[model samples]
Target: MKNNRGLLIVLSGPSGVGKDTILNSLLEKSQNIKLSVSATTRSPRAGEVDGDDYFFLTEKEFKTLVNDGGMLEYAEYNGNYYGTPKKAVEESRALGQDVILEIEVNGAMQIKEKSEDALFIFIMPPSRQELMRRLVDRKTEDEATINARLEVAEYEMSRAGEYDYVVVNEKLDKAVEDIQSIIDAAKCSAKRAKKFIDEVLNNA
Candidate 1:
């Protein structure tokens, strides 16, 4: 039999790098991969349901979880606490579901510190100019906000070298295929496949 444990993928990138779009496409084209849902301390917006939109928790409750090691990663964003819950991710992986945590650089680093087996991947923009074009094209934020995001993007990209793999989002479909290929190749790596191979050899 093949290895039964699922891959834990930590995906991180700059704010304007089309991570959401790439993830949407990747999920559609992949199987046995589950996107992780994070918990948040902020009040839910209209039509946003707990557990679906996010696991809404009080600040005290969130800190309690962090202290108990129930959080894989956590950070304060705009005064609201957001964190990836550890238990659900572990459960999904146990059932052979590859779980992807689409978090920021700081959170990704936290996961890395906690789990060395996690596969870390960073999504990159083709270039700085292209990245700026994307942020402007969206027209969803003011000029000041976009500039602030670009500054953060620069800092985030500096950390790309820390990741195990990097995918450049020049074309959506191609990026998805490349990420899928990375996952497929990782599954066959000697480190991951040796146990199953040994079992087969022993049986034979």
Candidate 2:
């Protein structure tokens, strides 16, 4: 019955799987989609700003936000907490902008529970061997972190079956095109285009 409901797009994959890279590219090519900046207890890295990369917060502040039901979803990893703020997402939705969240498997599942109609896309590396190779190639994490992430990747990959769409990142352009098609198709869904349907019926 809603005339202009927004699309909530959730993208999830393991670390070093190029989810962030592909998301960045998609944002560049998108016209009305906005990325949801997450709030994290982790300190800002070398060049990350307070509200740009993430909404950096202290443990206490993050706990406060969680307690007050301010976050859409939250989880702790590597001794730090990360969550999506509810306000920005709602604001963007009100403006009819597509809101994209680059979160983890757990968070994606949470969103699915809350928003059954949300678009869920799981990005996959070409293969496990390629995943490991990319992890090493990035050179961003220490060996211990990389290994830990790989193990987590195994678990996350297992959950890909739960997603609405699985995009294999074998080739950059192909993957992007696949994701773009999914989004475009979602926009034309009957639920989203009810007004158009009604108009045609009334005219007839």
Model 2: CA > 4 A from native: 1-3, 42-48, 57-61, 142-144, 195-204
- The local distance difference test score of model 1 is 0.92
* Model 1 agreement with the true structure over 34-147: per-residue lDDT tens digits: 999999999999999888879999999999999999999999989999999999899999999999989999999988899968999999999999999999999999999999
lDDT string, candidate 2, 1-204, tens digits: 344656789999988778877888889999878999899999889989988889999999999988887888999989999999888888988898889999899998877777757899999998999999999998888899988999999999999999999999988888888998999899888877778788888889
Best by lDDT: 1
C-alpha local distance difference test of each model: 0.92, 0.88
